[model samples]
Target: MKRIFDISMSLIALVVFCLPLLVVAVLVKLTSKGPALYWSDRIGKNNEIFRMPKFRTMRIDTPAVATHLLGDPDQFLTPIGHFLRKSSLDEIPQLWSILKGDMSIVGPRPALFNQDDLVKLRTEVGVHALTPGLTGWAQINGRDELPIPVKVDFDAYYLQNRSFLLDLKIILMTVYNVVRSKGVSH
Candidate 1:
């Protein structure tokens, strides 16, 4: 049921956002030296690694580490990167990952492949069994503001309480949070 919903919603969203996606892609290319889409190695369900595509928000020369880990991450931003990150426009390409079955529309957000602490904590709490999401409880709750342990706790809560209704709630709240651009520190 969840997979079916993911596919259906992803397909619909792709159709609805196709033009914006193209515009963003073109804008990214115009402003950055690298490809518009950045294929990041992310941890997915059961601790497996998958390539997740995001609109490239950082420059090609940026170190391949979590933005929070970077010293003065702003230095790596392409001209429009801050806007893309804050507006969450950089996430639009992940719909393709949803279509490809690497991600869900709602679940715990995927961790960077090198985020060993996050992966280990999630695995120990059994949250790694669930597929990663484009948005989730942790996202709406605090997003980039939450500490790793708090984020993992929210992921574990979703692991225990996930349902169609809960997903719907999360999706709605995600839209609200995105519109407000809340909790995104970087």
Candidate 2:
């Protein structure tokens, strides 16, 4: 049922928001000097790895590893990157992943494949067994502000208590956060 919802929402969004996405792609390309889409490795369901795509907000030189793992991650983002990050618009392309069943609309946000501590902690807490998501409990709760352990706790909570109603609540909270321009750390 959740998969159905994710797919349907993704398709509707892709169709209804096509022009906006194209505009974003053009903006990203004009504002930066790279491909409009960025594809990177991320940990997925059953602890497998998959390529996750997003609109390129950061420069092509960003470390292949996790953003938080870098010494000064913010220095790598383009001018439009901040806006994309704040608006969460850069993540729109992950709808493709949902369509491919590599991700769901609401689940624990996927971690970069190279984030050793995060990966280890997720495994230790058993937060890594499920499919990843574009928006999630951790995203609405605090996004980059929360500690990884706290995020893991939230992921574990969601894992144990997931339901369609909870997902709806998270989606609502996400929209609220996006509207208020709150809780985004980067």
RMSD of 1: 0.6
Which stretches of model 1 miss by more than 4 angstroms?
Answer: none
Q: Across residues 1-186, which tens digit of lDDT does each residue of candidate 2 receive?
A: 988999999999899889989999999989989899999899998789999999997899787976666788789998899899888899999999999999999999998887777788888878888889888999899888889889998998998999999999999999899988788776
- Cα TM-score per model: 0.99, 0.95
**Predicted candidate 1 versus true structure: per-residue lDDT over 67-179, tens digit per residue:** 99999999999999999999999999999999999999999999999999999999999999999999999999999999999999999999999999999999999999889
Q: Which stretch of 10 consecutive residues in model 1 shows the poorest summed lDDT?
A: 177-186
lDDT of each: 0.95, 0.89
Screening candidate 1 with a backbone cut-off below 3 angstroms (N, C-alpha, C), the clashing residue pairs are none
The segments of candidate 2 whose C-alpha lies over 4 angstroms from its true place after superposition are: none
Task: Please name the candidate that would achieve the greatest TM-score relative to the true structure.
Answer: 1
For each of the candidates, the C-alpha root-mean-square deviation to the true structure, in angstroms, is 0.6, 1.1
